[model samples]
Target: MHNYTIAELVKGLQSKQFSSVELTQHFLARIRQFNDQYNAVITVTEDQALQVAQLADQRLATGSAPALCGVPLLHKDIFCTKGVRTSCGSKMLDNFIPPYNATVVENFEQTGAVMLGKTNMDEFAMGSSNETSFYGPVKNPWATDCVPGGSSGGSAAAVAGRLAPGATATDTGGSIRQPAALCGISGLKPTYGRVSRWGMIAFASSLDQAGPMARTAEDCALLLNCMASFDDKDSTCVDREVPDYSASLNKPVKGLRIGIPKEYFSEGLHPGTEAAVKKALTDLEAQGVELVEISLPNSDLSVPAYYVIAPAEASANLSRFDGVKYGYRCENPKDLQDMYCRTRSEGFGEEVQRRILIGTYCLSAGYYDAYYGKAQQVRQLIEQDFVKAFADVDLIVGPTCPSPAFKFGAKGDDPVAMYLEDIYTIATNLAGLPGMSVPCGMVEGKPVGLQIIGNYFDEARMLNLAHQFQQVTDWHTQAPEGIL
Candidate 1:
């Protein structure tokens, strides 16, 4: 039951092979046994999960259950879960519980899915590695010493460890994909506005887009069916009709033009990762998917531009967490100003403060035009590069990260090196395009992800291609030793 995917679990529940309660308990027990090693889960929510499972069983028996009726999943902790502690891996929100659910959480409840727990992440979704999490870093299930990619590392680790079949995660510059790549799973980042962001606890408003992480593309498709919905509560949510994402899973991929960016195969990319990605491309080419060598002229500038834009947005979004509001407040402050300064300084982790300072500097009155304004302009050029590439290609393909999972503290001390971990993925967020990472192969026993980028609202097609690739490869099915 623990090894089964969401689609498989759904069928088993519908056939009465196992009750929802039984399935929920099976995963909960796994969490208790394995969580100490991985540090993937933040809160257990055992009582609440079993209660939800009981309701699902009742619905299943009455034949009124939705497609994913009895499925269990973990939220990224970035999403507010009403009474559940919605800590964004930061001490500031460690004791704060939201009174309302994030739109994604509400969507899962509507599908009758049981919430298992909340997963750890980079503090305020700021770090490239999960090391910055206030609860302690989430270790990679594959190699305990290696770091799971951030800020959705917890969700990716949980799914890879078989603690959950799928989990909800947000990607603002590869949080979902990088972790998925490192942990050997499937993760997606939908186009900005394709999924509602209300109650998601903003990291970088313009870059943050919620999606799913799971064992297979098929499972991700099933989860996405419940997650993608327009909500009036979120002004950024698009007013577009949601499609049956699973409907196109079996679609043929012959003659699909896949653009391989020349810039992606540069000096920075690890040879092992590059070799694995090329092998995956070879497999796709054999299936009649045309590979075209293309160039994203502005790709080199993505990292600098993203650091400016994302931090600027983050500075504004996180400003609400001052001691005056409900969050972590200083015990004793000499004055109002002292409270604000002490609260933020003590509550926020080092990485968060670093980003906030950078963001503040970028958005300062004197530097706004030279920094933030220019970065936005550079961002438009990056988007234009993608727009032009997509004219001749159906999708873009590349290594999700420049390298496979790195050892803990390998690049932690160097902020620039840490930021470059997301070099290949930040552009998609900047352009507001949908992207996904599928397990392709392993590099030094760590998994490499082949990133698939599609045009705006082309999630279905991207899933289709991923599903087709997965059908012929067994990479996605391979789990970490002792996981099963």
Candidate 2:
């Protein structure tokens, strides 16, 4: 029962094989039993979950429900959940109980998907490692000593640990894909406007995108189909139609062109991780998909460019939390300026503060063109690289992360070292392309992910490729010992 996939769970609930309350109880119990060790979930919504489960049972009885009806999934703390603490893993919003739900939350609620709880994440979604989270780092369940990639660390850990079948995650510079890779789960970062960002706390508006994290690509497709849509409130959201992601799951990949970027295979990629990813690519080739070596010359600049651009946008977007607004405020202050400084200094974590400072420096006069403006130009070059590559191939393939999950404090003191874990995933976000990390195989007893990057809005094709790969390989289903 605990190992059931989203598809199986939905079918089980509809067939009355288990009540929604029963399924929710199972997951909530799992959270209680295991989450304390990993610190995956920041808050569990038991009362709301049970209440929603009861409503789902009634809806199931009435034979009227959305596709994900009765499904249990965790919400990343970055998303605002009404009446639930949407902390974004920061002390600033730690006390923030939103009066309204994020669009993603509302979408799942309308579909009868029960929210199990809010999972932990890096503060303001700023760091590649989950250690930046004020609530504490989420441990990789595959190996308790290793770190779970972040800022979507908790979302990945929750799904990978089987605390939830699926969870929502937001990516800004590989937050979704990087963590999923390290945790051995499946995650997708759709095109920029694929999911509404209305109630999702901003961490880099241009790069931020809400996506699904699950154990399988088909499950991700099911959740994403329900999550993706156009929203008028988000001006950046395109007025494009959302396709049926699940419908493409069984699509054959025979004769499909898979591009292997030469730059991605360059030095700095751990040999074991590269070997596993290459083996996965070979497996795809043997299954009839064609593999072509391609190049994205500007790829190496992604990390540096992302640091400038993302932080600049984040600093601008984060200006709303000025203590006068709804977030955390100082207990006592002499004046307005004192209040602002004390509140922010106490509320923000080290990484968030570092980023805010960097952003402000870059966006300030004299440095704007040298830093932020140049980064945006480089961003265009990065986008063009993908456009050029996609012109010849159906999708691009690479190692999701350079290495498996590292020890908790392995890169703790070195921010740049931690940032490099996202070398491959960040380019896709910068280019505004859709990318996914699918469990491919393990390296050094820990999982290594194969990243599938698609052209903008080519998520359906990406899902098809991942689903086909997962169908043949058991990697997606392989859990850590005792997880089942």
Candidate 3:
């Protein structure tokens, strides 16, 4: 059961090969057995999951169940799961249980997917590595000493470790895709506004978008079918018809032109990862995909621009967490001023504080024009670069991360090095385009991900390309040795 992909699990449940209760129990047991090795899950709702599974079994009997009925999945701690501690891997909100579910959680609930637990994340989704998580770092299943990418690292680890078949993760500058690359799984980041963001704890308001993480592209497509919808409550959500993402996943890839950016293959990329991406491209070419070399010259400026824009928004969004609010509050403060300063200083982790400080400074009146305004202009240049390249390409492909999973603390001392881990991924978010990561090959015993970026509202096409590639490769089928 643990080895089954989400597509297989759906079939088994529909055919009554196993009851949802039994399936839920199987996953709960797996989490208990394997989660300690990775620190992937922060909380387990064993009783709630079993109860939900029982209801799903009843619906299955009626033959009117939804696509995800009885499926068990994890939610990144950043999403508000009503009645569950929605800790964003920060001590500040450690005791906060959202009174209402995040729009993403509600959608999954409506589809009858049982929530087994909430996974850990970087404090307020602020770090590149899971080390900033208050719950502790998530160990890469491929190498226990290596760090799984973050702040979706726990969700990535949980799925990679086979504790769950899929999970819900958000990408604010590559959180979902980077971890998926390092942990060896399939993950997607839908176009901004394609998925509702209401109740999802804001990191960088403009860059944050939720999507699916699973073992196979087909599974991610199925999950996305349930996760996406237009909600009036989320002002950012686009009003568009929700397509069945799994419906077109078997589409032919011939005649499709994919762009390869010169910047992606430049210095700093690991040789093994480059070799793996090239091999994957060759395989795609054999399937008749036209590869075209293109230039995204502004790609070099993405890191600097993202750091400015993302932190600026984060500073404004996180201001609601002052001591007087619902989260952590300082005790026995001398005055209101003391309470405000002490509560924030003590509650937030070092990484979160660093980002907050940077954000505040960037948004300050004196530096606003030089930093934030200039970054916005650079962001526009990045978006224009993608727009120009897309004229001749159906999609853009590259290494999801510059390298495979690295030993914990390898880049901890250098913020710039850690920020560069997302070099190939941040542009898509800046451009509001859909992007996904699929395991391409192994590098030093760890996995490398091939990223596919598509035009806005073109997720079905992206998933189709990924599913077709998966049909020819076994990389996504492989799991960490000795971990299982």
| Highest-lDDT candidate | 1
Q: Each prediction's Cα RMSD?
A: 0.7, 0.8, 0.7
User: How would you encode candidate 2's per-residue C-alpha lDDT over 1-484 as one tens digit per residue?
Assistant: 7799999998898888999999999999999999988899999999999999999999998877777888899999988999999999999998899999999999999999999999999888887778988889899999999989899999999998999999999998899999999999999999999899999999898889999999999999999998998999899988899999999899889999999999999899999998999899988998899999999999989999999998899889988888996889988899999998999899898888899899999999999999988999999999999999999999999899899999989998888998898899999989989999999989888999999999989999999999999988999888987797
Poorly placed runs, candidate 3 (over 4 Å):
none
For lDDT, candidate 1 versus 2, the one ahead is 1
Give the per-residue Cα lDDT of candidate 1 at 313.
94
Question: How close is every model to the real structure, measured as TM-score?
Answer: 0.99, 0.99, 0.99
For model 1, how does the per-residue alpha-carbon lDDT over 1-484 read when each residue is reduced to its tens digit?
A: 9888889999999999999999999999999999999999999999999999999999999976899998889999999999999999999998999999999999999889999999999999988789999999999999999999999999999999999999999999999999999999999999999999999999899899999999999999999999999999999999999999999999889999999999999989999999999999999999889999999999999999999999999999999999776889988899999999999999999999999999999999999999999999999999999999999999999999999999999997799999999999999999999999999999999999999999999999999999999989999999999876
lDDT of 3 by residue, 209-262 (tens): 999999999999999999899999999999999998888988899999999999
lDDT of 1: 0.95
